[model samples]
Target: MNKRLLKLAVTSALTVAFAVPAFANPFSDVPAKHWAYDAVNKLAQAGVVTGYEDGTFKGDKTVSRYEMASIVAAAMQKDLNSDQKETVDQLSKEFATELNSMGIKVEAIDKKVDNMVKISGDARVRYGASDSYDNTDFRARVSFDGKINDNLKFNARLTSDNMNYDDEFATKTGIKLDTANVSFDALGLTNTVGRQDLVLGNGFLHDSAMTGIASEIGNLKLFAGHLKDSNEVYGAEYGMKLGAADITADYVKYDTATNDVDVYGANVGIKLTNSVTALGEFYNVDQGNTDANAAAYGLKFNKLGLTALYRDVEDGANSAYSGMHNDIQTLKDEDGYKGLEVRYDRALAKNTTLNLKYQDFEKQDGTEIDGGARTQAAINVKF
Candidate 1:
């Protein structure tokens, strides 16, 4: 027997062994009479292989081991008869090394896709009114925190703020990037660089976002940044745990257009009882010419989730502590307003909370300010 004829016989016999029922023809190159036609047709019908888009099978061309591994992977998902399964098993053994490597590659791709990206979001709705005026607002924020590696992390927050009716009954919406920063640990300090939100000295002195670099050491933090569109600022904060009390203090200097101003503040919270806590804070902003000072004290009853707050603005005028219903125009010259605030917080669900607040405002003369009563209610949802 001729060697060529023997090889041809063996190849033909193997093709017949691998053949399946004739299916619809998809490839013009592999005709009904082709030796591997049945096998190719069955694999195509089962979605195991798709030949060239030009409608040709190119059956004579050789396939790389990697390509054959992909075909085997697809075929593994298909239902197979015993003969087909046996043929596939033999091919699997022949290409075992390539298939194993392919499996590892596929698992690696899946791991990268699953572990590298994460997302979370929160929403809030609020309604409040001050004596004769009323307003409502809604907010939503979404955060993305990606772990780039073991040492570095990237973070960003997209916020939608105060989409509501203005004084004229027209709707307005504001969207902004509330936070964008990268954080890392180096030189015995945790460092963050970029635009960020800062809460200093129990939020009595500063609770706003700015752009800068912040570093923390133990219970001390230092920051240098542009301060809320007013001036560039440099600040430091230190916190201490003292028995049943937590104490924090901060000092900041602002370079304003006219001159430099210095700000200093301290906040202390003492747990008097398991369910009762006392809080106190004082803040002072000093210009070269004058000073503005304020103090706030409060008690929090955790058992009932109620908080009572009192604020005394000493200057009554020209105060940097303007958050608690102080008019900058009157705060600069005329007396400022003193106020007592009460808040109640309750959990409504596993990831939802409700808050209610009432505020009473008065003048230094102990007289009630007209339309000085303010009330607010809000709901927060998270997960």
Candidate 2:
């Protein structure tokens, strides 16, 4: 046989044998006694070649350069001998443009493609109701992320919200710049600057972005930023991974005239079983003469995407510590309040999710005074 014919037969057999399904030999046209049968069978076992849907491999037919390039692409990841590698390299070069267009890595242009930037965003619609009132809202966000080089990266996000859509003209709408940050790694530490998402200790206490600098040191993270009208603020957070359990702790402080105080919190999450997890968290903050504390315990069902939690507040649940100020009373009428919450989330489709949540606590400012219970449902879509 001519060299081209022989090469085509060997390459086709290799691809067919390595890539095809395991139920049986895919090609009825290729017989067991054929010279290339052993090669084709071996390739099939390696899952390198998948024959035509009709279960046929025309062994005597020649393959085009594109077909050979595709076959060589599959074999590129295989443990090939020096001669086989040489043959694959030659074939790949002959079809470099086609291979690249098909998203196969042609090493020559891989670095060029790596320099591209990416953008992504999400939109959400939410409806919430209680015995006192009902409301609906819409939110949209867009983000851009880019790598400046091996050592630096940039990220930014813009968010818009429309609140309480009683009527088109009565609805409240606003736009905000959510995040604009740059991150880099240097001097044995990872650092980020500008406005970035910040969370501490299971996010039971704090989960909002601030304008500041954040640095990572081993298992500890330190951040300092100014938020709202507050003076300089700083915090240190640490986390430890222990087998099936993760423990996290944080200490944050806000600098103000008479309200200067420290907030400390800790949380632990344990994997109870393959599909069940248990979590507990505690937070405390002392503002001037009053000290407040919040604690919560919850169990999460991973398989069902459900969580049931109970949270309690003592002494003071005022805005001095809790970020959910609108949900808590300004002054305690009696001790504090306790609430039970159940949340469920699931994927409705690709890049879309449904969230349902309900909670009932003491009558705060937002919920009805008759009985402080609230139910909310939201759908989020990403692009």
Candidate 3:
């Protein structure tokens, strides 16, 4: 057979064998009523053939042996039944020279296209009862990661505000863009700019969202940003490994209208044994009128999947205007609360977990807030 007729015959056979669902015709030249239209469109959708840069399927044009080999290589990557596999094997054998010259080029292109973008997300359903309220709520977040180039990347996440099923499930709709950032490497530093989450020194000092720029070199990171409430924040953190322990130091300055607040702290984690780890953090806040400190020490039993922490936060110790660790529920209502929190986590299934937590907290000045106790259970899932 002639080259063009041969190409048409091979494509027609493959199209009938593969039998993929029809897609919207992508090439203007291949009209619905044309004899080769269905075959061409199916082959294109299967990645067995790509017509031209201008998106035209020139069926009358002859295809070279190398081009036909590329088509066979692509068909080899598809999921095929026995008969289809035998036909592809025969074609591959006929074009062995071209396929061998191509080497890993086809595989590289396939991987690049597959890894160009990724989507991931997680959701949580939580039930909690405290002295003040008992409720059930749900929260979810979806994230997208895109590669701009070898050295640059883009990421964004959409988050839903906690929807309380106990109260306004039907009327509450609170979905928003929570994080959007682009990161790249330049000037011997890794840089990120945009709205992103910031967590400093075990979250004893700050764990919130900020919009600005951050740069990291080795174990050190520097950032300058503003909070949702318009409070300007600048911080630095350096982490190092000493002996068998990991230590991190943090410094953050918050620029408020009335005064500038400084929060500095250090966190250390040591593996006491193969199954036990010790964690501690100490933070000192220097506000214009209020100067206080916060400290937390915890023990994690890795084998048991349990963690216990004790927190003693003085009033005004947390300089961040928003965001706090949920381990101590009282921190949401009263800042100067001292508490002991214990949590146990168990794997329910792949990418799913069951978590139970209990906290007992009282005001630092010996007063009770939110009944001074809380219990919570949550099921977390990721996909």
Candidate 4:
């Protein structure tokens, strides 16, 4: 088979591999007698998956973030209907704005041909200095978000690095997830479901639990969803909150998908006057004899054009969906986080001013796993 066809096949198989509920198909170009025959064969026959030069398909091989985006781009381009065309246009504009945060200019995008939907992707060549290593990592991602309704939406995000001299190639080269969700405000309630994000304790608690979150009352909300425990465990979160007090629990799935990692947590929040506030997060994971305990807290003060935050994390939940440390747990083990952030805005002139930010992160353990800190400042001009 042509090499291009082979690449296309790999991409197609990727779609199945990343499916939230992965479906393994059984089939192969080789005869059934081969023990490892299935899925790829079917995908190949359907022109979706491909085999290797050695006539062997590494079905378990993980696809990385960049490879996934290229594949998605390829797959989406196959259908050039008018509906899909409109979607691409709108998506491009949205992604352009998102990439702006990383200093990428809208005009610099070099979208590949046969592109569908609004092709938006970003590349960041970041250099960092840490005790572990003074290194550089490149992150490139392409994504598309299509509106399903005024209150509903669909989003797919894919990202990966340029090179992998790190981790010994133990991880996949790319990452991707398809999210179909609904979010709206009505009847005095803001309800959101499908794939989503979660935040608690001003980020002393951040959970991309993805299950769901609803703002049912004033300055108060309720959430229930699935989260991952440990490095490779799925858990569910059941939580309730009122004002400054919140309590939550997780049911980890022992036998299956929805819930395998469990956590119980609580937080108390208080706003001091109009410019000062404080919050804290405490979480405990149930892993039988290996229960884990964690906590995090933060303080925020803003008044007269100044804002500051002091945040820290103990053993917390771990949700790797977003590079964010949603729970107190860092994605990497032997991790602990502590940081301080202060941002100030001074209106030097009417409709123009400067914004400044400073942040620092030091892990209890000497690994990048503790999650680094960010400090940045910028000037803004209003039209």
Candidate 5:
């Protein structure tokens, strides 16, 4: 009924919300039963955070990158500073685009690491289940990207997760490149290359291909290679944009110990006005000279200042996998991965939002003919 009571109520529910790759932690400051604490109290009072039914803030606990983005954003929301706003906007774009290319959705917090070369990192100390000892991990990065020439620009980023977790840890410590970009204008057309994301066909192959080069000729966008086995698949993905609609195609091949395979596909997407968008695709695989087909479609709506999207793929039966087309398998039609998926995103604030996703794949009988169901919800924020 009252403001204090309202904060108390949601704080209880926020405890159960899944933060991803992060276990539900009761913030250290609030403890399990204490009512008032600095960190939790501020977030709770501002509607930025809450606690569990048990009533704990769990602040001292280690948080995942995705969750941290949300927390940082909540803290800076309602910020009206002009210069700060511009910087945050840039960080949000960069982060979101990076995570999106990985098929993971996150509210980009551009405000945290704007234009100025960023020097930031974190440390995580974990106490495994039923373990008396704590395992600690520390990682850091120093990134710089700015214009070197009037037309040429470059970027450099170095990061390390954990030496202890690496097994290669302590043994090796250095700056590992996480992301870098360069662009050039030669003669007439523009060419861009480096470790980055290529958005085509509404991202059906979103970040499907990692290392690549984007060369545009007139209306065509050509993407090629960086796909192999353990590292990545090296090949080419190409695209052509036409008025509100863009068509892209790619050929990726893999030769594993078990089998030699080829994946080829094409996608077409249309941006219908400012509020609606759609995508369609066709993909095929060639193994042992046998071909299998897969179809995909996606939709996006951004009207009234809200974004909603739906994507579904009807992948044809392969030699045998429930979700795949494994022609190399002994039992034909026994191994392939296929499924129906749906995802929903709603913006709760200018920075914080909610996401809900569901996935169901083709299965057989009692056990899960192949794949069953996947459901998850997340609250994302960006500073």
Candidate 6:
């Protein structure tokens, strides 16, 4: 076909595919009286076409396969009806080779859609009993993640926990915002600010949510935040890999009214075999006049989905924000505790899991506290 005929054919196809009114003309060469003016204007507004750098449509000139492929690729990114999508799909196949040579895949273009926000959540039913107490509860969490741009993201979670089955549905529990934060990259560091989750040194020293800012680069992270108790905390953690072992070191300081408390921790995991790993961690806390320490050693049987650990924590060693406070509730005491814990985890199906845990603890003085032995079973599901 001649150049004019070919250009007319292309313009007609785009006009039929995107039948929208044009607000303004972007190409100087296409006057309002021109035959293809509306079609060219609509294509420009939809990002389906960009004329030459000189700002002229030059519709009399023939369009190359590469140029047509670029237009098809851009159309694939738009929200279209069934008929429009089918038209674009046919065009994509016709120009697949040109699109691929230009570093764009027709299949990838077809999959492109506006998926800026995602919603996910998990629910759990748990039962636990100890020497002094037994209870059953349910917990649910919903999370929202939004991509604002290539460099910025926002995340939030709503959670309700410890809902008694016997209570009225509406009165069982109240939902609360557990986390809200935005993360971005700047100045060679990835930074997160707001209420966010934080874990340090294999969770031996701290594991909880904090309100403030955290920055990370490479294998090092720096954070300054406050716990639920309103005490400000500052910390840094560095991790490195050496041969078959991974090591992490961290330091945290709590800024309180009475005094500044410091904590130091080191954690290591060594691969012992294909299905077994050895883990160790040590933590020391300094509270001015008093000093305390905690240590743990464990073995992880990866293939069997089991873990066994022994932990010793002095009366003042454990952090109030430790995640263990929730997992091993019987061990929470001002007098400190030492314990042996065993856990078995297995996936029953996709996005579903079963967990069984048992712990035995005694006070530092070798006396058993009430509810010192505890066991729990939980089923968790995620979507």
Best by TM-score: 6
Residue-level lDDT of model 4, residues 104-138, one tens digit each, is: 33433533321333445554332333233333334
Model 5: per-residue lDDT, tens digit, 1-383? 25434433443354244233234333334343333234444444323343343333554544444443454343345432243345444444544654444343343543343444434333222111111212223445456665556677676666664444325676677657756678777767577777755444444433432455667666555655453224334456666667767777776565556666676778876867534567677667676756666666666553322233332323332412112211111113334434555666544543445555455544332234322454434444432
The 10 consecutive residues of candidate 4 with the worst lDDT sum are: 68-77
- For 155-222, candidate 2 gives per-residue lDDT tens digits of 99988845445556333456778899999998888999999887777566776668999999889999
The residue ranges of model 2 lying beyond 4 angstroms of the native Cα positions read 1-112, 167-172, 318-336, 363-371
Q: Clash totals for all models, in order?
A: 2, 11, 0, 26, 35, 0
> What TM-score against the true fold does each predicted structure earn?
0.65, 0.66, 0.69, 0.40, 0.48, 0.70
Model 3 residue 375 lDDT score: 80
> Cα RMSDs of all predictions?
26.0, 16.5, 19.8, 22.4, 14.6, 20.9
Find the candidate with the highest lDDT and give its number: 6
Please report, as a residue range, the 10-residue window in candidate 3 with the lowest summed lDDT: 18-27
- Candidate 2 vs candidate 4: the lDDT winner is 2
lDDT of 3 by residue, 1-383 (tens): 25434433543453333233212322234444544445444444333344444223655445566656655665565544344566666666666778768662333344547546777889987766675656666889999988888788889999886877546754776789989999999999999999998988766678888999999999999999988889899989999888768899998898988899888899998978646779998998998788999898999875456899998889887444433554424366576878897989754433455688888878888888766588877777776
For residue 162, give model 4's deviation from the true position in Å. 7.5
Stretches off by above 4 angstroms in model 3 are 1-111, 319-330
What is the Cα-based TM-score of model 6?
0.70
Collision count of model 1: 2
lDDT score, candidate 6, position 191: 99
